[model samples]
Target: MAADVKTHLYEWSTTEGSNLPVGSTVVSTNLDDNLRMIQAVVRYLASSGTVASDTTTDIGAVDATFLAVSGTTTITGLGTVSAGVYKFLIFDSALTLTYNATSLRLPGNANITTATGDVALFLSLGSGNWNCLHYLRKSGSPVTAGSFSGLTAAIATNTIANGDYNQNWTWTKTTATKPALFIGETTASSATDAVILELTTAAASTASAAASQSAHFAGICNRRIRRRQGVFGRRLLVVRYAD
Candidate 1:
């Protein structure tokens, strides 16, 4: 008996440097469709979008790279989205993002931008709702100046923004019996990043809660704060831990 190995294959094959002009025949099959699906994905990521102005270009349903013309941009949305479907968004500069669609959520449940040399991937959760999978760093300088603020009772980590940043601070947290560090992930997208309390030391801050209340970090990247046990009142004085 022979084993059946199913592989995604396309109906047509192309050689290197062979250009398939637009409006070419597209004969597809089940297997070929799968391959074309992948091909479409590759095409999306490979294609770049026009320099987008504020709320000018509408986000397409493919991998379209949007080069920031100015500082930030707000693109139109795909009013109707399917669950598990996503788009690959690439940026050339540090630009903010916003959507003119209803219930479309990005990282932090808000309009976030891509850092230089970074790519932001957004996934649709059906019903016109979308969320950012995360921004991948393609090239360029890493993100910096990560500082988290205090939320109602939880630590407001998203305020620090997203990027590959280095920490150079003496960590501090609220007065809790079991205090821990967590890198709150992109809201409802990626998993919550956890920071091990490896070397918690005593703090001498005027707002410090207890002797062992500081969550000092060495040098960490992708610095996004997630408030968990940092009581709103008690404060954590920090400098940068490490890069």
Candidate 2:
């Protein structure tokens, strides 16, 4: 008697202008299927990297890169940066910083200074790759001298008039530990408000909670269904095969 061998071929399709939501099971098939799924994820991330519109209220979403500030106020939030380089995008009218620790000062040659409504960028150094260890910010008022132990350097300040706006802060993190990314919003009459801090890095020392396996193939089938649709629309497929 001869041994029997079986092979399976799968085909799926979707119409245009449809949003495909992906789940896990469909992602664990063969190397080819996995690679196609990963490519879709990368495309989604790349598309989200651009900045979005602003809002009147402080509440907003942080895409790959989008920040919006409204009114005159001050707010504080925590930033737990991973051990890698990062860019901090500030989308506000005016801002100021108050370092929480002396060691958190920006590099001397970073060229970060305080000015009313001036767009600026700062680079952090020393730790992993010049990332900030810790820091703070204040709005509605210029950062006063002696706000922190390391008062030798001038704080970066920007001023914005009524109905005017300023945005874009590109900073790099060079440390493994997380730090605070603060913001201060200066309103028209010297008053200020604060915006929330949006985190960009993945959680430290945490594992994904997804299950290892499942019996139902509907979840998996739906994933393949979505991928087939995405590939047809995007016209480009990036596949990574690993056994």
Candidate 3:
């Protein structure tokens, strides 16, 4: 009789006596195959270093677990779905990893633009599903610059819109006027202590404020406000940051 094999790992299962007396060749062959499979899984081999990425990336047929993929194609999935499988992927160049709710789930529910040397760890959840456990960038810093708003004249009260609250902000007073007092929403308090600056002179002064603190901004935009009165024309530059 032929030896039974496990489904997931493809390991062999046979009675001890099945190989006794006239040892069955089937059992021995199946045992060797299982060993090979186990070895490949444990080997953690790397690819030839030029694997082009596609929608579904193949780390390797067997042994390869660490893959360096390069291509313009956006990867949406990894190798065939099998539960309890892990893959470490390194981006050889800039590429996008699409976020999918079912097939592929990313950290922020947003597509990631990978930089060279960026690495991501993924785990298969069976049923053609993969979840990114971790993503590390080579630069070690993730910064997003938001749009800059320009003001023509000085105003009595400056309000930060709710939408602009969640970004790293750099406000510059190119015009010569600066707001005297900074007041956010009466109910809104700062999420954390962030860097606030006061530029006395118009030296193209640049100041940054934390974006998206805890909740709403209390209806105030990030502006460089000083206690002393000055001109009010300003440009609001918003930058989104991730730590």
Candidate 4:
């Protein structure tokens, strides 16, 4: 004799703040129903960063270099960057520095061997808070190099060190206004190193918002688990959603 098989159905309303009683049912499951709900939600948030006319309202080509850091260097050649939050990509290569008893500073002792390959990005928190993100892929080196956002605050002060390539930077600016790209390099003779820089722009506000929402939803989804068991034994399903 074979064991009897039991089938069950579950139903939940999509209404806000509603909880229904849980019970088994004999009706056929509607697999497509849940997928439709998810699709709808994703579509709603998908257009946050899309712009209609990027050319008319985007940052164009810009090039900037920082040989000596006396004050904050503002990238030039870029027209007024839009008022909204913006992210920047930057690349730096060829750094030479001299160290004294207390500080490190860039010296005219070294020069970047290759001035066209380093890269970095930054998110400008309006009013002088530029967060730097960087990336460097050395010539003939197998390692792919990059730095995450929030690495360091904008270089406000310059320090000098003896026999060290202490402070050298090359960067570009881009945003919703001038979306062009550019590169630059800095080097010191005493130091045998070179740096390259490249830049691009990203949407600071939209990206951050999406990341936060994803983290919140992930936390909720991780706590729930679904299991099914039958003649084929037991199986567990874990579901996670992100945008």
The CA-based lDDT of model 2 is what? 0.32
Better candidate by TM-score, 1 or 3: 3
43-106, model 3: which lDDT tens digit per residue?
4443334468988776533345677778878888776645666778888888788889987889
Candidate-wise lDDT, in order: 0.47, 0.32, 0.61, 0.30
Give lDDT tens digits, candidate 2, residues 87-169.
Answer: 34343444333233332344332323333333222232323223333223434442333234354644887654444454444
Could you tell me the TM-score of candidate 1? 0.34
Q: Residue by residue across 1-243, what tens digits does model 1's lDDT show?
A: 111111212212344333232234443334455455666645655465544434533343324534333345554453344466555655656666664344555544455556655676766666666666675666544333334564455565554454556544565746664435554434444435333332233466343233434265533444554434444233333322433
Can you list the residue pairs that collide in candidate 3? 159-221, 160-220, 160-221, 165-212, 166-212, 167-211, 168-239, 177-231, 177-232, 178-231
Q: Which candidate is the best by lDDT?
A: 3
Q: What RMSD does each model have against the real structure? A: 18.1, 34.2, 13.3, 33.5
In model 2, what lDDT does residue 73 have? 36
Write one digit per residue (lDDT tens) for candidate 4, span 93-151.
33211212111111222222222343323333333333333323344332233344446
Q: Quick one: RMSD of model 3?
A: 13.3
**Best-first order by lDDT:** 3, 1, 2, 4
Candidate 4: residue 181 Cα off by (Å): 46
Model 1 residue 146 lDDT? 30
Candidate closer to the true structure by lDDT (higher is better), 1 or 2 = 1
What lDDT does model 3 reach? 0.61
Cα error of candidate 4 at position 78, Å: 7.8
Better candidate number, 3 or 4, judged by lDDT: 3
